[model samples]
Target chain A: MIEARGLTKRYGGKVAVDNLSFTVRPGVVTGFLGPNGAGKSTTMRMILGLDRPTRGTVLVDGRRYRDLASPARHVGALLESRAIHTGRSAQDHLLALAHTHGIPRRRVDEVIDLVGLRDVARKRAGGFSLGMGQRLGIASAMLGDPGTLVLDEPVNGLDPEGVRWIRDLLRGLAAEGRTILLSSHLMSEMAMTATNLIVVGRGRLIQETSVEEFVRGASGNRVHVRSPQAGELAELAAREGATVTYSAALAGASSAAAASTFEGAPGSEADAIEVAGLPSERIGELARAYGIALYELTPRLASLEEAFMDITRDAVEFNTAAPATSEGTR
Target chain B: MNETHDRQSRDRAPAASALPTPAAAASSRQPGTATLERGASARSRRGSAAARAGDAPSGAIAGDVTQARVMRSEWTKLRSLRSTQWTMGLAVLLLIGLALPLCVSASENWTVADVQAGSQDPVYQSLAGLLLAQVAVGVLGVLTMTGEYATGMIRATLGLVPRRLPVLWAKAAVLAGVTFVAMLVASLVSFLIGQAILGSHDVGVSLSSDGAARAILGAAFYLTAIALLGLTLGALIRHTAGAVTALLGAVLGLPLIFSMFGERLESAQRYLPALLGNAISSTSPARLTDLVSPGRAFVMLCLYIAVLGAASAYVLTRRDV
Candidate 1:
């Protein structure tokens, strides 16, 4: 398990990681989700004791990382895929780390084959492609067969197959009762692999929840009804306690006159409407009762990416268009 | 039907069922139940077996990151790099190559009365390569630390041993040991070859002669000290070009810069690395009255390393990787 309490880091006047606390438990892949510059890497660095925390403590297996008799045996971290000497071969690099804790040479070879890097193990790491470099890094992290794994952007340079490979690897490690904390900006990836998620935005804790709870908690579970009688159905759904909004494309799809021709029409073009707090079945039944020819009635569960955006909307550090209050200096 | 079943299982299993078995976990296939369980069980088996075999300190792969292990790691690191071989090879070559030709020419000139007019101190004449080889040794030392920072390997390194100081100590110990052994052999070989070439000339000095052994050994000592100084500098200035520039400038530049102060500061220049290098490599005492004793020069080199070493250790622990 990895526990960070009140961890804070500041670079000059800029805060990289603010007061934050979280526990990464074993038997699950805990996804550390954040947008770019969200301080995910900084927090991981503090956990590994690579960066001194300005004001708090982080412990791996209930002791500070430095205090562990053999840190690699308890905590294996891949902070950066290319955090290796390019001049050395993959085998030598793993061996060097293994020698630090007296980990046997066979373990190094084992990890090399485990990561499917046996073929290129003897070549200089400088020549490896990004995918190969990431493989070598994963190999190093697994060299000690540690009880915990912390990987940052593990799939950044991986192919589709490699991405699937890492998801499986992390899950397998977690199943062996190891705490797995993997960080990524890709929410969909995290949704697939992470059992629990600790999400941050602009260096502050936004939420910590299971992937299922996170998706379920997003506000807009809505049904989209596309029909020539959308105007009448939107009114009928609104009267039944569903929130209705005109789909912008509706006006362009059919005709402007067909929409604005009716005063107080819910839909602009009278072709489509979005109804929230109502199931597609109910919307379809309502259209049937009104004898409205419905072409499409589909429930749209918010994508994980959309849910992430909604959760981090206030906390996003980089927004293309400035919202309000002029907080860009951050 | 198969795709539907796969998607149904994936959607129904929740987080716990996502774990694959060992056979499917061999990094060959897409995520499957067999792969997750196989990978998990295989690791557990290996983990417990290895732990029971005493390869690790605990039932898990646990052992203290001791100083000895770190030193061995540094040895592996020092040897694995191609630059290590190139720089060390150049140092050895420069030491012996320059000594052979220069000593032979010096011996040939001793026969001519006009040639005898040249400075004929055999020890200093024979070890001319010591001057150039110090550069090579210093570069090796500088690169040893800076290379990690350059490639970002330092993050991985310190992540494994977060106590931090052990790394510096190990690196210094390994580099110093290697430099001492390699440079000492070079110095001794050069001296023997120089003496062989000199062959009974007035300037010829045997290993038994006064200060002859001290001079040869001190050359190695001086080179090792320079290497430590380079390491200390490399730690302080983590960039390769910058650290090497700073090392070369400090070692080679300070003497000339100090000498510009002229006679009043002449005595002070003896304490500088280059001057100390010269004194340690000489067979005779300092010709200048103000120059320090050879024994004192050796101590001065150690003092430089000590001060830099302390500063390096301090910066290393306090700074972010």
Candidate 2:
């Protein structure tokens, strides 16, 4: 189990990681989703005890990382793939880390094979491609047979096959009841692999929810409606607690124009129409009240990226929080 | 799937410690909180547990990353580096292979009367290679620590071993060991070759000889000390060009530069590393006991290394990676 309670880190006047808190429980892959420079790497570094938290603390298995005996055995972290020395071979690097905790060299070989780095384990890390470097990093992380794995952007430089392999590997590890916290900029990857997500923006926790709940919550469930009176309908919809957009109006107008031009059949892009935020039934009632015929009414569920953007557009501002304020009150 | 089975122990933050305080803390928080009630309840739950564990003294560092392990790791890292091998090889070849031979032939070609007129002291005269060999040793020493920073390997090194002092200490330990060994071998080789070339003059100095042993031994110690000073400077600078410039300037530059400033400059110049190093290798059975002895020079060398090493440790431990 990995838990961070009010963890914060600061660099000069910049708050690299704000007052953030969350738990990554075992038996599930908790995806750490954030925009670029959103403190994902900083948070991971703090968890591994590489960067000290200015305030609060992160614990792996009921103890701070440095406090744990054989820290690698308790928590395996790959904060950056470039952490390995380029002069050493893949196997040598893993062997050296494994030796630190009395872990057998056999485990090093096993991980190399596991990561499909066996083909190049003996070759200098200097010669390996970025994908190979990531594989070597993953191999080293697994060398200690750690209980909690923290991987930051593990799929950053992998091939399509390598990406799929890692997805399956994460699932397998979580299935075995290990705590897995992986960070990624890719929302689609997180959607496929994560059971739980702790979304962060500008170093503060935005939301921590199950994938299903987060997607649904951010989606907001507003249906799209169109009319020539889109501004009026949007204002009406906004007052009614529904979010509306201009794209739906364009869709409705395109449909209206298509019907007029081609034998009473509506195309998807009729012009001179407004898109309303109300449900289809409600839009019909309102359209009838306004005496404006509805050209198009479509139920739209926002994509994960859209929801992500909507939430984080407000969140990036938190990245500019005072360094002193970032130090967790906890 | 089996979340409940992974029940972890109570651990919150380093700030929390003990049961009574935890109980008090839990109660201290408003039982019925306002808007943040959910997060508040979770905090109380975990904070109380953390207090209990922390109140009891935390266990010793897991595996206890002792100075020994750090030293071993540093030794392995330093020795395994290709730079370490290349530099050590350079020190030996330049000091023993090239400089010793050049000086040996130069002294051999000189007439007996001319040699006697030209020489100030045999102890200083026999160890001419010491001057030339220092460059190689200094270069080797500087690279021992700064090379990691240059290659961006310092990040990986610090990540594996987070405690900064240990990493610095380990590098110093390895530097001392490697420099000592290489300096020792180079000194012995230079000594024998110098003696071989001086065969006709019959000013033979053997390792078994009394005053001969001290000069030979002192020369070895002096070179090693000079190298360590370079290592310390490299660590302090943490940049390859900066370290090399500083080290060379300290050893060779100061003396030559000071000589140009006349006797007044040369008088204070004795305090420089090479002067103190020369004081160490200076030999005379009766006179050695007085003036600047090998013992004093060795201590002075240690003092230099200690001050620089301490500076490296302090800066390293405090700076964020």
Candidate 3:
């Protein structure tokens, strides 16, 4: 269990991590979501006791990380970047860390194999690819086999296979009752992997809730009503609390302008009218009462990407939208 | 955070740490209860126990990193890097490689008058290589401490051992050991090689020659002192180029500047770094002298090392890593 209360870090005149508090509980995979430079890395550094907090404190397993009898045994954190010496072979790096606590050499090989770097375990880490570096970092974190695991952007620069491997490994660890807290700005990835979400924007906690709840909450009230009675159905949907905006394709929507078809399935488009503070069930009830046998009754939800973008729209310190080019590797 | 989850985690780690079989050991003791009392870092009320509470989690049986472990880690870090070896090799090559030939070439043109009057000490004359080689040793010393900061490897070091003092001490101890051994071998070999070439003028190698052994041994000590100075500068500057440059300025630049000004001002020459370290062989008519004894020079050299060393440790321990 990792609990941080009012952890703050300031570098000279600029604040890196402002008063932030949250607990990563056991038996679940909690995703730490934020845009780039939103203080995710700084928070992780303080969590590992690498950087000192300007105020308050962080507790890992009910004690400061440095105070732990064996910090590696209780918590295993993989920071956003790799920390192993490049000159050393991957195996040697893991072996040396294991040796510090007198952990057996067998565990080192286990982690190396677990991360699928068995082919290159004996090779120098300097020669490894960026994906391989992340793998080795993950391997090192697992070397101790602790109850709590912290991985920051573990999927960055990974191959699809490597990304899947990490997702599976983290899920397995969480299944085994480990407290798994992984950070990433990849909403699509976290949408599939995380059981719970902790969203931070501008170094402050924005929201902490279950994944399903977050999706549901971000979905809000936007829904679609497809009926032969387009005008009457639109009126019924509107009375049930949804705007009747016109679209150029699919089901026709009525407004001050002439009839135009709506595009796609009503649920996925970003421009779809948001029906806030209403349930999907209410839309269904209104559609049935209007004798409009719903051809499509879908609630438009902000996608994980959209919800994340919405939350970080103002908080992003660096780039906001994904760069025009493809995301490198994973 | 990962360190917390690591096998040596702060909470359950001590019991698991240093134990070959954590499972068997933890079975004998009641879990969480003992860890709660001694494992957690709690704020206790009042004096003694509070003081003990400040150190409550410190005395655990496991994760006990001894001084030996620290020294060993430092040695491994120092030796494992290619830069350390490269620096040592440069020192040997500069001192032994260039200086031996230079001394031999100088001897070819030597006159009896030149030998007797140009310089009082011929052996010390041949040992000028030390002046150049000390820079390489200084680089090696800087690399020992400052390289960690450059590579972000210092974070790993501090992670393994949070208290900054032990980390600094370990680096010093390892550098001292390596520098001592390297200097011992380098100085002896350099002396032997120079003696071989200086035989043309009958100006070299009289082991029976008074001050010869001390000169050779003192040269080694001089190099070692230089290495310590390097380590001290590294701790202070925390940058390889910066530390090496500062040390080179003090040992080399200051010497030239002092010698130049001393050509005019009276006693400034005696205070030059080259003069101070070279004072061991500075005796003119006598094999050793009372006015500027080797012992007193050794003492001064030692004082230079001590002041830098104490200041290094003081700054390192008092500040965060």
lDDT of 2 by residue, A1-330 (tens): 888999988886777788899999776788998887789999998887777899999887778876654566566677654777677677777766655555556566667767777788878888999899888887767655666899999999988878876776766555445678999888888877777889998788999997767766664455655545555555555676666554523443464443343334333433233233456677667667767556666766666777687778755554355534434432
**RMSD (Cα, Å) of model 3:** 9.1
True contacts kept of each: 0.55, 0.11, 0.09
For each candidate in the order shown, give its overall lDDT on alpha carbons: 0.79, 0.67, 0.67
- In the order shown, the candidates' Cα RMSDs to the true structure are 7.2, 10.1, 9.1
User: B52 in model 3: Cα distance from truth in Å?
Assistant: 32
Interface RMSD, Å, model 3: 9.4
Q: If ranked by DockQ, best first, what sequence of candidates would result?
A: 1, 3, 2
Best by DockQ: 1
What candidate 3 gets wrong by more than 4 Å, as runs, is A104-107, A118-122, A219-221, A225-277, A281-300, A317-330, B1-62, B106-119, B260-274, B280-293, B296-321
Best of the two (2, 3) by TM-score: 3
TM-score of each: 0.84, 0.77, 0.77
On TM-score, the leading prediction is: 1
Residue A164, model 1: lDDT of 79
Q: Model 1, range A284-324, lDDT digits (tens) per residue?
A: 88888989888788778787788888888776635434534
The best-first sequence of candidates by lDDT reads 1, 3, 2
Docking class of 3: incorrect
